[model samples]
Target: MSIREKIVKEYEFLKPEMIKTIGELITFPSVLDEEAVETPFGKNIDLCLDKALEKCKELGFKVFKDSKGYYGYAEIGTGEEMIAVLGHLDVVPAGDIAKWESDPFKMEQRDGKLYGRGTQDDKGPTVIALYAIKSIMNIGLKLNKRVRVIFGTDEENLWRCINRYMELEEKPSMGFTPDSKFPMIYAEKGLLQFNAIGKGESVVLSGGGAYNAVPDKFQYKSKDLKSLEEKLIANGTKYEIDGDTITVFGKSVHAAVGEEGINAIKMLMLALKETGVATPSLDFISDYVGNDPYAEKIFGVLEDEASGKLKFNLGKVEINSEKSLLGIDIRIPVTISKEEIVTKIKNIIKQYGFEYEERDFLRSLYVPLDHTLIKTLRKVYEEETEFDSTPLSSGGATYARSMENCVAFGAVFPDGKKTEHQPNENLAIRDMDRAFIIYAKAIYELAK
Candidate 1:
């Protein structure tokens, strides 16, 4: 039998085990909760890592859980070179259960598709990677390198999970993360996180729950009902008017691919000034929103020519007497500096006499598109899918950036693939089987 056929046979044997594990993992709601002592993100993260470690032990591989709680491996090989298969266990919280045809956490097979939040994003790919390792082990493939599958915790928020992993272990020779679109990732844009704070007391505001996913539902409240209502309508914006609550409506869109949703908070804040509620801080926000004279000035400093995609999200907001707080999220292009962005926000806040603080600073992750790890994985995907798509850039950050010599792989296909981060997040059963086979081949080739 050919190498491909051998890998397929090994994958066929692991199908039942893979299905059960994936289903069990999909049952937990791994949403990031800052309120908990250990961090809600860490709790779900530990759960996924434990599950993975248990399975690896069952498959008779030497497993290691570091002091920081990240999962690691020591698969035997004779060479100094190491091959890594990086995949995250954490997933973005399912936005709304009402929008889903089925449960977001419960894995349901519909017309051959598996539907769940982490199914396509990372969990499904994680399972595929696991079985691929199993296939290589079962066949006793002799290779010159050590292959490790590192499971990370925080890909959605800050990536402390993978950072701790690197601190404990040696960097891999080459690796692939089945987190992005397939057929080789030639380039990924630089990712930068920005936190902007709104000053003083104000009302009529709203924002997003997660920085990555688009904000589906945004609500804003203001004490001055008449001005808020009038400005909303005058701007040709549709809004819901109740006794005292006025919520503006806009199409919610993925923050990275800002095609539809205009930020409701920005709209409401900009409206506050137009409706005669002007403060110095509002002027700063207006400029940042591309409304004032400083839009062009900020872009020159923030834009990256290599990636050529600049995206931003107005993530969160709170209205109070001391001040109205707004969380501004920015995905900086390749050329911007984290320090520069922070400095800009500080200057803007100082100009308005508002207090400025950086909540979370996420540095941009860049892997040259021409790297060998990406090119080899891309070749395998192209040969399998028979499609001619190029490696793509994403505004959101992943664990791939934390690990050296690593690039994102499958999980999300082309735009035509099933809805991800949407109400009915799911994966096809046939596709799950196919992914297992593909990952098996990828692991075998890389491990050998």
Candidate 2:
């Protein structure tokens, strides 16, 4: 049989084992713990990293671990140039355990889907990449370059894992990360996280998780909510009134697509303003931001053709007797400068007595469509799926930005649903089976 045919047959035989292996990795609640300073990211992440490295070793690939417990890699083949396949073992926290159909740490198979936290994000894709490498070996494919699968431990928060990889490890000649959707992501937008700090003295309220996700729930405990119940219902906000506690409910999604989410923080702020219980922060959203996730009132739908519109996410909010602090996440277009975006924000918020404190920024990434890396991956993708499409751009950040000539390849297909950073996160079984074939063929093409 041809190498492609052999890969298909091998993956079919190994699909059952693949499901079992993914379950093992998901059992770890690998959320980042700031208190665990002795280890990188956290202890749970460390254990997860160790478990991934152990699996790589079991696959008979030469493995290496960072002395500082930051990153690990599994390699196969012998050559001067190396191709990196990036995946992260860490996942976002499962927001609201009640939202999940099962334990977010336990993988479940139903209706051709695997329900778990990291299934669609990186862990499942990581396993698919591993099996792809193994399948190529089983088919006796020749490699002109070494292929390395690098496992990162902190992708949900700061990318310290991949950042350290760049500092301490040998750079790959070219690579692809399976953290994004197919066919190919040639350009990604710049990311900015900052807090809009202003004065406030009112009822206390707070909500949200990371700077990169649209918070699903925001709770405010105050007798003022009783007066606001009618306004909240009139405004069409999803919420629950429990005695003195008012909880606003919204759909959680990645900040890159913040427009799709109903920000509970936004809903709560507006409701406060409507109920005559406005703070400086609530009035800010009510007057300036409103319900527009694109922040058209502030920036006039700031966008460019290369990376689309700037995405705005009110990731976190706090209102207390002292001050109002709002944590905001913005995905700026590839052609836009950080200063331009920040200046625009300052111009708007400063009038409301708020100062923008810069938190974290990831520079935008763009690779020309004609580049060989894009061409090779694009050719293989079209061949395998019989679907032809142009290279896509994204607001989402990936490891592709960490290296030269590297772009994010697929774990999610074009038609597949995105469950990353959300509760009951899942990956379709059939899509993963297709990814197995895609990664195997692409790896062989890139390395050979």
Candidate 3:
């Protein structure tokens, strides 16, 4: 059989083992922990990283782990040029365990889908890519360049894992990360996270899943719970009314694509304004920001052919007797400068007597469509899938932006449902099989 055919046959034979490996990785609650010193992120994350590297070693690949337990990589082949397959092992915390149909940490197969926290996001994709490399090796294909599978542990948080990895290792010649959509991505928008803080009255508000996910539930405390309930009923929102508190429910999705999910914090803020308990922070958000997913009021009609329009997500909100803080996440267009976006945001919030502080910023990534790496990956995708799709752009930030000559090539297909950062996140078994074939072919082509 041809090498390609051999790769496919091996992948089919090893599919069950691949599924089992991913399921095993999901059992660890590898969420970030600030108190842990030796592991930094947490013990579970450290354990997950160790297990991944151990698998690499078992497969006869050279594995390396940093002393700090931030990042690790497994490599094969021997050449000056290296192709990196970047993926993360860390997952976001499972918010509201009752929301899941099965245990988020325990992978359950039903209707040909694997239900778990890290199934679709990174862990599953990471394992599948590793197995692809193993399949290539099984075929005894000698590559012209080395292939490195880099595992990161802090992608769901601040990306310190990647940051530390870059500091210690040399940049790859060219590479693609399998953590995004298929047909490949050529550009990703800039990311900006900031807090708009201002003093408020007796109102106290707190809710959200994470900085990267839209808040699905929000709780508000005040003397006007009855009025808030009435407004919520009129608006047709899902909510719970206690004696002096109201809990509002909204759909959660990745902050990168905020338009896909409802922002519960936004709903609560609007309700507060309607009930006459509007603070300056609430007034600023309600009037200036409103419920629009795009920041049209702040920056009118921001868009470009590449990376689409600028998206916004009010991911979090915290209100107390001292000050009210609104955590805002913005995906700016690649062509826009940080100064332009930050200046406009600061100018608006400063007028409301609120202090603006930027927590993090990831610059935009744009590589020309005609580049060699983009063309090679796109050709491989079309050849494997028989779909003539063009390279795309995204608002989601990936490790692709952390290094030069890199883009996010997917484990996610174009027609697949997006469950990243959503409740009951899952990946289909059929999709995993297809992605492995594509990744194996791409890696062989790149390495050759």
Candidate 4:
């Protein structure tokens, strides 16, 4: 049999193991908890890293875990040069338990799909990449470069996991992360996350979790919120009330595709505005940035052919008697300068008595379409899926930019299910099976 056929045969037998391993990872609820001193990410995240490395050892790959508990890696093949597969194990908080069909931490298989918190985001893909390497090992493929699969614990928030990896670990010659879609991502938008803080004493409000996910749930309480609740229903939103506390529901997707999901913070503010509520943050949002994901209302049209349009997302919001704050996530198109965008934002937001303070920034990434990393992955994608190998530009930040010559490969198909940050997050079984084959062959070609 050919190398591809042998790898496929080995993986077919490993499918059950693959499911178990991915599910085992999903059970960790490895959300970052900076307050936990047991490890850099959190107790659960550190334990999750330990479990993942244990799995690597069981798979017979030489494994190493960072003493600081920020990252880990499993390696095979042998050479001075190394090709790497980097993915994160950390997940965003499971916002509301009632919204989930099953426990978000426990993987559920039904209707040929596995549902869980981290299934489609990074963990599932990370495990698939691991098994792909396992399959390659079963066939004893000759390698000219060492193949390393690095696991990070902070892709959802700050990429401190990757930052620590670069500081201590060996850099790979070239690699791909299976954290994004198939066909391959050649360019990624720059990310700008910040808080817009100003003075206000109008109303009390707060909501949201991660800086990169659209806020899908918000909780607030009031003595008389009946009018606002009616407005919420009139707007066709899902909500719940008990006593004086109310929880408004919105759709959550990664901020890269921010427009696809609803921002719950915006929903509450819009309803509150109708009830004559006033706050510095709420008033600014109503006047300048209602519902439009591009922030075109304020920034005009920031678009480029390489990376599509700029995306604006209100991931968080808070207002009180003392102050008001807006936690914003912006994806700037690849061609746009971050400085230019920030300057315009400062000038405009200052008009509302708010100061923009940057929390994090990731410069855009681009690998030429003709580059070997892109071409080889494109060839493999077309050959395996029979899908067109059109290179894609992404707004989601991946670890591809962390290394010198790395690009995001696939775990999600071009027309596949995308439930990354939302409730009922899941990955189709068939899609993952296909991804297994693609990953094995891609690793073989890249390493050999």
Specify the highest-TM-score model's number: 1
On TM-score, the stronger of 3 and 4 is 3
Q: In terms of TM-score, which candidate is stronger, 1 or 4?
A: 1
The full ranking of all candidates by TM-score, starting with the best, is 1, 3, 2, 4
Please give, for residues 150-264, the per-residue lDDT of candidate 2 as tens digits. 9999888788999999988989988999998888787889999999998866668777868899898989887556767887888898999888898889989999998888888
Give me the runs in candidate 2 sitting further than 4 Å from their true place.
94-110, 195-303, 310-330, 339-356, 421-424
Q: CA lDDT, every prediction?
A: 0.67, 0.87, 0.87, 0.88
Tens digits of per-residue lDDT for model 4 on 92-188?
Answer: 9999899999999999999999999999989999999999999888888888999999998989887888998999889998899888878777799
Q: Please, what is the TM-score per model?
A: 0.76, 0.72, 0.74, 0.71
Q: Cα lDDT of model 2 overall? A: 0.87
Residues 248-282, candidate 1, lDDT per residue (tens digit)? 76657766665456666566677777877766646
Which runs of model 4 end up more than 4 angstroms from their true locations? Answer: 95-103, 194-303, 309-330, 336-357
Residue pairs of candidate 2 with colliding backbone atoms: none
| Candidate 1 similarity to native, TM-score | 0.76
Model 3 — TM-score against the truth?
0.74
* Span of 10 residues, lowest total lDDT, candidate 1: 290-299
Superior by lDDT: candidate 3 or candidate 4: 4
